[model samples]
Target: MTARIRSVNVGASRDGVGSRGRASAIDKQPVASVEVRDPGPKRGGLGSGVVGDDVVSRRHHGGSSQAVYAVAREELDHWGGVLERVLPDGQFGENLTTQGLDVDGAVVGERWRVGSALLEVTGPRIPCATFGAWMGERGWVRRFTERGRTGAYLAVVEPGTVSTGDVVEVLERPAHGIVVPRVFRALCGDLEAADEVLGARVLDAQHHAELERSVARRTP
Candidate 1:
């Protein structure tokens, strides 16, 4: 089974996840579906936000999949029709919402079909201060680390347009079980956790080195 996209909503901040100022369920018809929008001279649109449709990543700006998880069609519809209560303070800012898929189990390089658009699990999006700023708390980043429920980033594998109310199904799984959440936990200030992450082999050389450095700093 796989989770399907119930709808797509984009805003500076989420008073709700849909157009009705409320979270739209998977069934209630998506208000605004998300797709990779290409920008010309102007940099800032649907796909890449500020840096345009390119691989430009800074602190909190770039093409990163917000939330990827498994849910039921009814849950999708319920959220679409009403407010979604996920965060500690209760707000919504999901790039793509779906139903029934083990997202944490997903691995890098694995591709999935979410409507016409094909999304590949590129890597994990590192949490930064911007997320904490959005939450109105300096230590809100700790919530993710403490909870160990960080989401993964998706890169468009095939050029196809995606819309609201599209079904999301997993097409592949990684050979290893080193999921995103595990990576997040391993990246914490703890050296042991960082070493665990180093053993995962999911991270690239740069990321691996970064983790190694972080771990070494804590070493005696």
Candidate 2:
């Protein structure tokens, strides 16, 4: 299969979709197309980089460094088999459900041209209480983290439109070779790998804060 977006999804803010009964936009639905752009910093910025998509919480979701979320259809399928459920595109709250791309294997700072937008691989999606609640599987957070196929968070480097069936092309990759899954593991508890994450200059400097914070937590 060609590297392409199988679906573009967006969700509106909704009640009871977040941790502690807070609002969330996790139940994304397919859309024909959407516009993507930098949403500025996490606080005091637009909610979602994809226009019309609502990110109810800005505390740790949606921003320039996480302007978009993309997940591999293959990964979704694999999880579906393990979970014994039919997982649809965007079921994981990813904005783009992609085929024929290694979302988790993508190196940090790798750039892709999705439709007309230039997006950079910023980091992996970290499982959270909201995500666990959304999944409704017992120990969902722990299970997902342990599996470590966390997909990718992308930052829009060039504003443009994206649509289902649009080509997804890798334009560049950093030689540092730190991939999304490795980064996830590092952030989780891999102290040695966490050092790599903190020390890698090839990684996006804009996202270094989070990596550093994670490492700091495990430091002492």
Candidate 3:
């Protein structure tokens, strides 16, 4: 089946939500349409799904490397089955909820054509304390990390408008085999595995630096 966007969700930063001590855009709601664009360097990073979308914490979130986060509907379904509950799109705070895509298997630097925008897979979304709070489940972060199905973070390569049901086309895939799951495990579990992904030239500099730091810390 051809991969496609199931929903486009976005939200603004507000007070009293998540573990951020403020409302997080992580609680994204589906929208009919949203403008996708690079916010430009002057704006602090790549723009998110919609014009009013918020990036509450610039310290750890947002930026070109994580401009847009995407999660697979298949994974959501799997989780729903495991939890015996309905898992909705945007429940994980992803900007794009996609269908028919192996998001975790996508290699870093793979370019996806969604609507008119071109997006490059940059890295995986690491579950955080805020995510655990959002989920309202004990050990949610540990459970998510252990599963190693973290979704992909994308960087806008060609900005354009995107909407629900837009077909996602793979325009390019980097020769490097630095898939999302591998990177997530390397970042969160095996520090030694970081080298393989760092070798991928197409990886975003920021992400590369992060992996480098991880490797350095474990090199002693």
Top model by TM-score, which number? 2
Residue range 123-162, candidate 2, lDDT tens digits = 8888889999988888999999988999999999999999
Give one digit per residue, the lDDT tens place, for model 3 in 1-220.
Answer: 9899999889777666778575676788899767777655425564463566788777778777778889999999988887788988999988899999999989888999998899989888988888898887778899898899989988888888888999999988877777888888778748656776766554666667777887888887
Q: Model 3: residues >4 Å from true position, as ranges?
A: 41-43, 46-49
Taken over the whole model, the C-alpha lDDT of each candidate is 0.50, 0.89, 0.82
Q: Candidate 1: where are CA atoms >4 Å away? A: 12-31, 37-57, 63-92, 137-139
Task: Return the TM-score for each candidate structure.
Answer: 0.63, 0.94, 0.93
Global local distance difference test of model 3:
0.82
Per-residue lDDT of candidate 1, residues 74-185 (tens digit): 4334433433334311132345545465555666557788766777664555545444454444465665457555455665555466666576767887776666666766
lDDT rank order: 2, 3, 1
Give the better candidate number (1 or 3) by lDDT. Answer: 3
In candidate 2, which residue pairs get closer than 3 Å at backbone N, Cα or C atoms, i.e. clash? none
| Model 2 TM-score, 2 decimals | 0.94
